[model samples]
Target: MLVSNVYRPMVFGCRADEPLVEVARWMVDNEVGALAVIDGELVTGIITERDLVGALATSDDPASQQAAAYASTQIRTAELEEDAREVARRMLDAGIRHLPVQDRGRVVGMVSMRDLLALETWTA
Candidate 1:
């Protein structure tokens, strides 16, 4: 199956300069695992729940105001044309739940492990 079959366009997103606290709060409020980090018209990075928890775990204060310090700038992405199985495999192998889907260098949609699992033939 193709990613477009299950892609969600209404997913959460944030700018690179957005405060990490805002990102964290968006994840909590939306009950999602990650948010796509947008850089102008490009999909730059992704900040996941795991990233947040990891940052908090190593930090002396979880609620400190240094939000930007906790957000992750490194990200992995997949093309909208890629097969769903490939996306799922990447997510599983990386132990991540979110994959930012880009189309022609623009942020298009996001795919979650949950979305993949709900598919009829997701193996990862």
Candidate 2:
């Protein structure tokens, strides 16, 4: 199965300058674990729940921080036609839970561990 087969449609994201509080609220409202950090049309980084927690724990004024401060600049992306199993393996090896799904250099969706595990159940 391709990533397109299992990935969730409509990538969730926040601007790099978005406040940490806003990012946290967005995650809660969207029911997502991570978000792509976009600067205009570019996907600059990825911010996960772990990042948020770490930032909150370390920062005296968490509200003053932005997504760019906590988001991981090194992000792994998955092609729409890439094998889903391989994507899962990549996530495992990278110690990441989410990957932005891209098509022709444009982000279209995101695939998470939950999606991959659900696929496992179906394919098994």
Candidate 3:
């Protein structure tokens, strides 16, 4: 199945200037591990629970840290029409749990590692 068939539509996102604390709050509220960082409808990067943890680990004041500090380098992404297994492999090789799904230059969804695993079991 293609990524669009199984990708999660409930995208969690943040802007560059959004504080880390706010990012953490959104993650908590959404019960998700990551958030896509968007700049005017384009996905610029992603921030994850691990990113927050890493920032906290490196700094004494995570609460004061900016979301941009923990935001990941721009990632390789998949189109919603790409195969699910292909996207899963890309995420696995990159050591990331989330893949932002873009359509015509705009993010439309996300596929998490858990979502892929779930798909595997369902198909099996």
Q: Which numbered prediction scores highest in lDDT against the true structure? A: 2
Off by over 4 Å in 3: none
TM-score for each model: 0.79, 0.97, 0.93
State the lDDT at 29 in candidate 3: 91
Per-residue lDDT, model 3, residue 39, is 74
RMSD in Å for all candidates: 2.8, 0.8, 1.3
Stretches off by above 4 angstroms in model 2 are none
Instruction: Supply the global lDDT for candidate 3.
Output: 0.85
CA lDDT, every model vs. true structure: 0.75, 0.94, 0.85
> Tens digits of per-residue lDDT for model 1 on 1-124?
8888887876477877776677788878988888877767665667778777777779776665343455556677778788888899988898878887778766677889888888845544
Error of 2 at 111 (Å): 0.3
Best-fitting candidate, scored by TM-score: 2
Candidate numbers, best TM-score first, in rank order: 2, 3, 1
Give the Å error, residue 85, model 2. Answer: 0.8
Q: What count of clashes does model 2 give?
A: 0
Better of 1 and 3 by lDDT: 3
The candidate 2 region of ten consecutive residues with least summed lDDT is 2-11
Of candidate 3, the 10-residue stretch with the lowest lDDT total is: 36-45
